[model samples]
Target chain A: MAASMLKVAVGSRAYSSGIRDVLWKLGRLNHVAIAVPEMEKARSFYRDVLGAQVSEPVALAEHGVLTVFVELGNTKLELLEPLGPESPIRGFLQKHRDGGMHHICIEVDHLPDAIQQLRQRQIRTLSPEARIGAHGKPVIFLHPKDCGGVLVELEEA
Target chain B: MAASMLKVAVGSRAYSSGIRDVLWKLGRLNHVAIAVPEMEKARSFYRDVLGAQVSEPVALAEHGVLTVFVELGNTKLELLEPLGPESPIRGFLQKHRDGGMHHICIEVDHLPDAIQQLRQRQIRTLSPEARIGAHGKPVIFLHPKDCGGVLVELEEA
Candidate 1:
């Protein structure tokens, strides 16, 4: 894990980490999520037109989403559809009728530590606590306002 | 390659392969592009804050944007900042303010054939001809309306 600490380039005051908190490291991008108005159409487009291996739709009722995974060689594209009236995606779709890119999910080594460290750096999260994500892992969403207008989800690896 | 296919699950009528036109395939996702209002801050956030290996900013004068790459091991996140008033990113930033997810680039084995086939399927493109992308590859932007409100870029591999 010392290699993780060494990743902070030399002479960088941006981190201010004389403490060397190597407890967590951000990992590979898990998926780029797109909220689609039509789930089956999006699934067929990626699987058949794009010729990518796509997974069957999984309903994450707890997450208020129906997800279909489109497997790219390096990463994945998650197509999400609103499951219920109260789904967050429903509001997003109302604003963007044709649907649009929703958010991005990246893997993190430690969720709790990352959250604490991010908050210290003035990054606000959408929720007060971590919740189980679509992948059934501890996940928390950083506020898009804090993340340069992009909704970012950090999931435990 | 035939192996590029065989990924399509059975019972997909999307391709309409009565003529068996398998001339091109969509490959890996190239990158997810995000237009940021502030380049230096966005660069530092991904690098020092997220602890990712980030690339130096590259100015694309022809493209009218400055680009910084955040390498996520498996893929990349492209942070773009507008270079001039005429830049397309300028418009994006004006709308998003803090910055937002722009477009996703996907690789294709053959660009021309994919464009033609996509046109046949009623997929509208922003331009009739492919242009040189930031990576110096032939790329075309698919119309967002046709793609469920997602601006998709197809780059030739």
Candidate 2:
């Protein structure tokens, strides 16, 4: 594995050593997530109207949401419906009412390296550590505040 | 150069003939667009904080937005800032305050065929016709209402 040290300059100080982090290895975008008030409506729309194949809704109780995948040639569209009143998506749906685009997931070669690099640059990650995502892969979320109000998920490629 | 026919069944009608639409030719997602209130702040955040290579901001007068590309290994992050008070992004920024993800662009092999397919399915497209996009490629947008509240842009690959 090739590793490169990144010299990050913060304000007046130059924090240089031990930055033996791998170069940015985040890969292809896996999918774009959409928050919806109703999953079946969104699913039928894509399947019947858009002529796209959609997966059956799967409930990820741990994540507090029901998820469905709209299969595309290159990437997938994930529909998220809050499973409970306390689900995070419920808050988003309340604001949008009609629902709206949510977070995006990208594949990464090395999650640990990516997280370390982000932390070194003072970017706050949401989860304390990586967790299994709907795809059954290790994933981590970055705080939207740091990414211009865009929630980003990094998953193992 | 490859085409496949999709036999879609609508209410009381089975449209099977001339289904010679291109098989979901859209390739890997090219980028996800994020609307921001400030260009320089967002640019610096992705460049300095995220350790990503950011492009110089470019203004698209026709679109009424200034755009910047954050280059990643397999995809890109597009930052959009409204050019004037009348810009569409201005309204989004007003409502979101902190700005938010706007849309996602995907690459398609045959743009005309894709548009035709969408029309056959009765999905509303934004630009009555394909127009030049940020990448100077023929692109068109599908209405968010038709896409489960996600603004989807299809660009010629």
Candidate 3:
């Protein structure tokens, strides 16, 4: 939002060294997900302490998470807590006892096209097909190893 | 931006169980940072493959890291690479060979007031003082332990 306020740091626009990729355009970053082991403490920090608009905890049974949305004006932060024994983030919390920044979700105009193009580039996706995410949108996660070790979720927003 | 489109979501505003924290309001999220071990590959993945506008790497000797920015419409992702052997993120990269999510920066309207208030609440800051950050603004790093294991940078914007 304030990028224009800062001086131009030697042409910020990336000139792709390879063929211009125009398969599908990516939209804004939807949300940065944080796996919070201490969900109450995390929620209080963002809501009561930071004075941000925060949503109540919603149990996403299918996704195996109890999620809360913290609005940061421009975007949102999703605070996730393991809901069941087989919660996807359970292992992550076990490894990082205090919790941590999990996968980030970015919006895309055309999810199918984007997925196909990524696969063609040998970018491994966690799933072959997009699934309905907690936001009720078609979303697919990319393998962290293939994407430089950061889990990325592309949502059809 | 699309929060309204989602079902009411049980009235998404935090009512602050106690006194409202009006000391300082948090602005939009500034950037989400990722530490990159293989800088070239990480840059290409976001630029050539994701088709996102990324910035040229800028080395900040003081901060001990090389920074690249990926524009995500609403927000940005800062790609950080250790600048020297004693770089702050060096240990992080060593633990995570392929690199991983480093920190998330959030804009604060008033840095000093926010710092004072947080201190009173017993939330620890990595530094007692705010220093000029990569964006040339006063920023302070909050303790990850107190922040639910997320390294949060509060920048005065």
**Clashes per candidate, residues 3 or more apart or on different chains:** 0, 0, 0
Residue A38, model 2, lDDT = 82
Instruction: Give interface RMSD, per candidate.
Output: 6.4, 8.4, 4.8
User: Per-residue CA lDDT of candidate 1, range B46-93, in tens?
Assistant: 866777777778899888999987877777799999997789888878
**Cα lDDT tens digits for candidate 2, A1-157:** 2323455543333332222344656577788899988887887666554556566678999899998776665677789999976787888888788778889888878888888878876778998999999978999999888877889889999
- Enumerate the chain B TM-scores of all models: 0.87, 0.84, 0.88
Index of the highest-lDDT prediction: 3
- Indicate the DockQ of the complex predicted as candidate 2: 0.27
C-alpha lDDT of residue A83 in model 2: 94
- The chain A TM-scores for the candidates, taken one by one, are 0.86, 0.84, 0.88
C-alpha local distance difference test of each model = 0.82, 0.76, 0.85
DockQ score for model 3: 0.46
> Where is model 1 chain A poorest over a 10-residue stretch in terms of lDDT?
A10-19
Model 3, span B74-157: residue lDDT tens: 989999999988899999998999889999999999999999988877789998799999998999999999889999999998
Question: Which 10-residue window in model 3 chain A sums to the lowest lDDT?
Answer: A1-10
Q: Candidate 1: which docking quality band?
A: acceptable
- The candidate that wins on TM-score is 3
Q: What tier of docking accuracy does candidate 2 attain?
A: acceptable
